[model samples]
Target: MKFLAILILLLNILSAQNNIGIDSLQNNTGIKNNLSELRTELDDIFNDPNFSNAFWGVSIQSLKTGETFYKLNPDKLFKPASLIKLFTSSNALLLLGSRYQYRTEFFIDGNISNGILNGNLFIIGSGDPTIMIEDTFEHWLDSLNHKGIFSIKGNIIIDDRNFRQDKYGAGWLAEYMEDWFAPTTGAFCLNKNAIEIKIEPTKIHQSAQISFNTEFIENYEVINHVITSTKNSAVEVKINRIGNNIIDLIGKIPVTTEPYSVYIPVNNASQYFLNSFYEFLLDEGVEITGNAVKLDEYDKNYDFNNTIPLFTHKSEQLTKIVSEINKKSDNLLAEQLLKTIGFEIYGYGSTSNGIKAVKELKQGMGINPNNFIMADGSGLSSYNLLTPKQVVNLLAYMYRSSEFDSFYKSLAIAGYDGTLLDRMKGTKAENNFRGKSSFLENTRGLAGYIKSADGEPLALALIVNNFLVPSQLANYIQDKVCNRLANFTRN
Candidate 1:
């Protein structure tokens, strides 16, 4: 019995030493698997006929052990598309805390006696982009009506002083300026600065019915030329903007099909907000004699200091807003948040200042700022370029920081919600992957965190450019790679 006990102790010591040896090997070499296997797998994926001419960049590292598991052209720059929102969002969380909220204040210059003797309504916006036409505007009107003020003899002045007059992002395509995904950015945005147009088919061979979601239908002249077709027929629809206020809709809709709706960005977002608010006030029984005007149109001598406070509309918390920006890939909200960072940190809200702030933040986070170029916050511009190393570095930094919880939770979970709702469903990566996905004409990217099979956390960034294959193919490759990472275990 004594001999057996001694033998068991010796075996236990040997097992402990073996485990330490394995850990020491991993720590010294940074990974347990042979680098050749990973390289060959990546080469096989990239060397496929579909990506014969594509440029690829990938970087993966274990968060727990700080081991670089794989790297392929990690330093090569590629268009990041919406993946750049990661920078904007993480930086926003670091600079502006998660509890930050945007405030829009209402100030009146004159007195209110017997619901009369009112003055110009000055609305000073702090770049709140979440204001919707349906609920937010109605709430503002209700606030006014609740205050016992129904009439405004003076004008409605919109003070978007928080941001510059530049509404469009730099390098944005002129053709896509009116697209819903590329709506204008401003201190005050309503309905995402877009209008919803619903088209329904009537009887077969009859003209299709057209309708607008907003009461400000007079804002645009619709020239509809649509014909209803038989069931199961191909439905083709096209909307073209001929002039500032003229929109031509030409299409063929099937009678059996449900109503189709499309959202288009307006020409001028500020004016659109004013028009929508004017209509909302009319509906709420509030009378305003003067026209809704921008702050620049008012006299320079108007005293803003004497303005009395009515009510302020506070936007949702920054955490929720950042989730919308990341999960939905909202361009306008990302741009606005970028500018807001600049305005909050510095005194001016401009893209240049915002980019400068982002660079400084990146530098502070130990990332080499010179490796990446951020022309626009939302990555809508083709000029935006980032190396996979830079993205992975950022993700790793965020993963280890105190703000990690907020930043990580804001990302799109695979097969769960956000932009990744329909992707990687029922797979090993379904709940194990959470990241940001990006797509442009010829660019695709995915970057964020993943959990390995042994429950080790990992940060990864994969970017592909100039691929002749469909973007879905790139997504499939990424999903497969993530699955491999999800099943990875240290031997």
Candidate 2:
């Protein structure tokens, strides 16, 4: 009887093991079927007639399971546009740390006596791009007043040698050279090196009032051709810059239209910096006995080792600046950061050195150099080329980095803030999807992170190039992809 009972017990145990195996197999099959469905839907979406002629380079990977969910020409090179800012921001975070600060120092070649400076005031720029007329210059004037030095007897020299004098990115369109988005970069930068032009319609058949946003004086000449039209007329305005600071306003504005503003790139950022500071100094009752001159034009030179330090200005931390680059797509700031990385790593603040620094950082992250070509830190350059797979791979790598929190938070959140504020609204992707958006004439890209319905983290890169369709159509496709991914579940 005991042997028979033991035999039955062994058989029961074997039966239970077989049943467990069957259940596990069934679950695996279900998962495969679900993934297959996901792929089919995505394929149909991308195969839409509107995108039939466009190239869609897409890559999506599971951050939790290390699984590639989908890929469409993932290894093909495409113009990443502003999406290149992702790489630039990541390189900065790794090389400079999130807490890194840019410092601009004030030095003197002479002594201060009887409320007067008897020598030149040398301002050395360490590529602090965020200096503002109100925030930085005002405080500086106050500090000068506190020190009892209200008058200067020597020249105000700008030592702008920290960065190369490359004003424009290579491969930028010639037509956009004077646009606000194409502002020149220099070691000594203020107010992003751009000026805002505010236009308001007065009366019908009258000229529109064009004014500068900042109170500081500028030399740009505006030949106003824009006329106020009927109250119901559509607002049509055009701006043209010719012969160094001459701007032509050629269009019409309706009398009922609200104030319209556009930002224009300054002619000379270094000179503009000086002009702004000079205006501020004069406004604060400070007397100057010498002209403001850049070091390149100044005939006299002084040894840096013998100069006495006066005051120093520090910028917001790197993380805040990175937020400006990715979220707001600030081209000038991005360029400044690229040059800064070069200065910090290679002892020169040139675009070439910055590219080298980024390449080195990418290699450290195990990204293949052959997969992409980086022309500039800001995606404003059409010379930048990247593969979707490589971008997603980079995102995955960042996800595992210690600075992931800072990097992730820098991206624009869909329907909430930054560049993606109006996109993906009223969908599952809203507030869940975070990414960086880029647009050139014919290119659109979105790259960043999202969490699936099952709570699985994902990194995605979707780039559309060579499309003749309107940009809204391209945006629709990208937003749809985000919504689909945001609702994806493997459970």
- C-alpha RMSD of each candidate structure in angstroms: 12.1, 14.0
TM-score of each model, paired residue for residue:
0.90, 0.90
Where does model 2 exceed 4 Å of error? 1-33, 213-219, 256-259, 299-301
Q: lDDT per residue, candidate 1, 1-491, as tens digits? A: 98897677567544533443233112223333445666576667666576878988999988898888888898888899999999999988989999999999998888887786378888887888899887998788778878877898888888876787465688877777557888777777888777898999999999999898887754678888888999989889887877667888888999999999877877666777777788788777778888888887777566777888889999999999999989989988898899999999997777888889999989866677897899988999998988998998899889878889999899999989998987766456776799999998999999989987678899999999998655766776787677667656665
Off by over 4 Å in 1: 1-36, 217-219
RMSD in Å for model 1: 12.1
lDDT of 1: 0.82
Candidate topping lDDT: 2
Q: What is the TM-score (0 to 1) of candidate 2?
A: 0.90
